[model samples]
Target: MSDLPLRSQLAVALGRTAAKMSRLAGKGDGSVIGGRIGLRLDPELLTRLAKDRKLVLVSATNGKTTTTRLITSAMTPLGEVATNAFGANMPTGHVSALASAPSAQYGVLECDEKYVPQVLRETGASLVALMNLSRDQMDRAAEIWQLAGKWRRALAESPGTHVIANCDDPLVTWGASTASGVIWVAAGQHWREDSWCCPECGGPLDRQEGEENSDWACRQCHFRRPTPQWALHGDHVVDPHGRQIPLGGIQLPGRANRSNAAIALAVVAQFGVPPEQALPLLAQVKSVAGRYTTVEHQGRTLRLLLSKNPAGWLEAFDVLQPAPGPVALAVNAQGPDGRDTSWLWDVDYRILRGRPVFVSGERRIDLAARLEAADVQFTVVDDFEQAVMSVPPGHLDVIANYTAFQDIRTRYGRVV
Candidate 1:
């Protein structure tokens, strides 16, 4: 705890020791040492030192990592931006990011939804980006209403802060309604339209009729999904700068990425970067470590999609190509990735469309049972290597949960 300035050096030493111990004991997940070090450190010291630095905090049910990375890429041309790009979006992770960064002018962090309020209070972020909220980690995250209550209080306390919000989500729209100022980002019909029911009234949300792009309105009351101050229409971004940046050639797939790109553009737009300048920077960005990242293994290409909840899983399934070959799913019931495996039932597994799936992980049997109940045919393999090897030497798509994502990437000997 006393070793504040030497934290990075100590982390490196402890990481090496943990790696050696794991190798000796033939164990994985070298988290024991990291956990011990994390418990011993003082978060106050990290926060006090970071007060002079500019901070950008991004929080949501999904798209945090991808959006954080994209914002960081755009902000890099302006100044140094520190971030936790490895999915460690916790309090301790923020401390580690501060310890590891090289005197940055700005800090960009992807915060967990549950921890965002605490993080915002501790870090005093100048700019905060709140993406859509949805049902995620229900067993651990309590109810969606409870989470929304926390966010509402958090935003209310954070006055005069530049807020970037997604107006498409009902809960987020309500939370940001009282914000001092908000830059709203909306998507076309490509955005997930599954959870559009009004959070307050339980009435059906209305969408624009006959329009290719959809906008939401409450059928029962005046609570409506506010028109985005900045919108992404197809590849063009109508920016606050009055510049329409053409951003058609994004490498990442799905409509969700467009929403993420819009949020990233909004964040950078606050820093006085023109949309035209930032869109080109965002266009050249690649996927983050685990979210839809592709890697090569043994002469075959494997695309890895990290799906932690039903909404994220559904979005990934939307972008998945239904090929005649094989598709693999890795499920886990480990800590930090939720212990209850019932969320598998909530996922629209019917999207598999009779295609064969190879399932593996700690919760492999549970996932297999869910698939069977859904009348989906799947081959269950407890061994990770067996599952990967079972894929017929072609383009393989791997959809995995938080814990299983590390296993699949490690097995393929690829950095995600």
Candidate 2:
């Protein structure tokens, strides 16, 4: 940072100062505001700070934060990794991350779906991982296919950047199909309503029914799920050598996390790190941004999980404990949460029919209506703590949307 151009050095220094002030003021961790000030001072700060760093960008609707954290952990053994570990996925956050660790040789950034192209252009990332695309924040963001088209154009222009893409998702497959170099991964997509049609052709996609690595092809075009170099089988990720790397001991729960681990391992392998070498590091990650964090509060074990959209909620359901264990859900229609609760209907709440369910939040009424329609019985409480107290003393799982999740985290002393 000292050797940077005078303007860049000033920008970094001011950014750090502003971030410190932000932390002092209890505004935030200073990631966003600090970077915003730096970029205001030097428009090229992100590009300048990103120079000489080996960067990888991870973007997706459901698992961006988790996957980014996983990749960061897997790469830590190689060198110091500068990353946006707090779920800040914008350009400003990118600047803050790069500026904070000027000496770090590696970076793993979690990018928002819409900002992937811009971040890729600015950072010139060596590897950009494309995971599944789905409907999220629909009121504020572009359609899934439109976002994919932007990614396709961006990847096409950057022929030198290698792409690690999920082939099971038609939108993600179409996005990376135009890239010069692509490493396809057979990461399972549990939600299919968003990609019922072929991204390349305006026709229905023919999806083959199978247990793992199911095939999907367009009826109107030749575009289809590419033969993946790495595939996620049950409890393992199949490497290029047909070796089954067991995803055991990963503290994060569910097959979605296993898929995240597969992608992270595939990413580290590009830097010559073997899966065996990275697996232990990946297993060390217990949670990302408090998504799967388990905390003991009020004599009850509460596992916190975040589910901002239908795809996220489906994955959250997959990680819940066995039936009859009390589960609490909360939702809020805030600016960050897109201010639209209609997407609640897309979630299948019938899966909670047998579980003891509790609903609470600013939008708990909306969630309750959906639960009522699903024929699931749930009790509405004032907030997360009240819901937790209503359940038994042993264990309870909590799933909440953006603002609601943060509220609970705040009550627990902010577990980030």
Candidate 3:
């Protein structure tokens, strides 16, 4: 077991070396070594996690990385926290991250939906935060219900663990029913449009109907949205004890982010950090790269929105108010991000609203076809540079899928 750590260290070093070689060889996918290392070291890494270590696992289709980052960042003021920041949410990624920090006081890690069961079982985390379950990477993740089932079983076994859940998502609410203690955080009515229907009943879900804000409930059945044990009212997130954490000028936008911000506050609150101390640090935290990140090209500003799935694309569209200039969107058929381009249909393309959109990527044609079918106007470009060049100067909106996001970031020299 001692040698296992050394072997894992050697493997991680070799993986880094291989990644460098791949980049030098001009065959950089940026995921080659991480992928290989994840597949190989996962089993050995899981076996090595000591039961004494206190683990905090965060999972969801969207916002896992961002929420994990926020929670980890907020927790740092309290004590040592080990985390996987690079979207490595699977078993191997958890192992690699854990292996990297052998003696962390707390393991604050993000976990992928499909890998949550394995991570929970092996890592033995004291706290598990499930942000929300949405349709993402459908080809790999299957239905939302299937993922929920796995989580349900996993949570049943770990009855002692604390669970942080988004009450708006039915899948997460159902999955977290068995949790020992759940800290719920919900977005107000402004962002609740997409969640009106129950995923379970195909019937209208009852929402707290006051205004057009994001408040939620089940209409047809009695499965109503739970009033958050911890709730966010604009910039203030209130815990169950009525303690208020004033979040001023968060780095991310929209009500979706409010939900994430609330969860982050709740997670940090669980670690006993006073709301006053942690609330001040949130304004300093920045959005994860490619997720609403803005870049300057020549004299114009291009905002990058990483839309990896239908729910993500819809939410991105929801958050965006109509911009004055033309919008640029990119979609790709790459692995990990999925080669199947059909998931775009699930997005509310009608929201485009006759905006002049420039589409490009490996699946540019597919995007164009979908736009055409929806009667939305768009011009297609195969070259990303040409596509960016096509956008007129001054405040451009750009939305791109996974590979395209990396491509644009690389082109702009923003990749880490």
Clashes of each: 1, 0, 13
Runs of candidate 2 with Cα error greater than 4 angstroms are none
What TM-score would you give candidate 3 relative to the actual structure?
A: 0.87
**Order of candidate numbers by lDDT, starting with the best:** 2, 1, 3
- Where model 1 places Cα greater than 4 Å from the true spot, the runs are 1-43, 188-197, 201-204, 208-213, 241-243
TM-score of candidate 2 to 2 decimals: 0.98
Model 1, position 40, has a per-residue lDDT of 60
Residue 303 displacement in candidate 3 (angstroms) = 1.6
Model 2 scores worst on lDDT over the 10 consecutive residues at 407-416
**Between candidates 1 and 2, which one is better according to lDDT?**
2
Candidate 2 lDDT (Cα, whole model)?
0.90
lDDT of 2 by residue, 112-224 (tens): 99998998898899999999899998899899889999999999999779999989889999999889999999989888889988878789999987655689989998988
Tens-digit per-residue lDDT, 1-416, candidate 1: 23345764565446446545865786643334443464365335446546777888898888898999889888877877888776668776676566556477789988888887888788778888988777677767757666776877887888856688877666777766666778877643333443567767778887776542457788998888777777777766677655676668677787778878888888987887767677778877767885677777665678898888887887788678665556789888888788988878877687675676898888999998888888888898878667667766668888999879887777675454
With candidate 1 superimposed using the best TM-score fit, by how many Å does residue 393's alpha carbon deviate from the native?
2.0
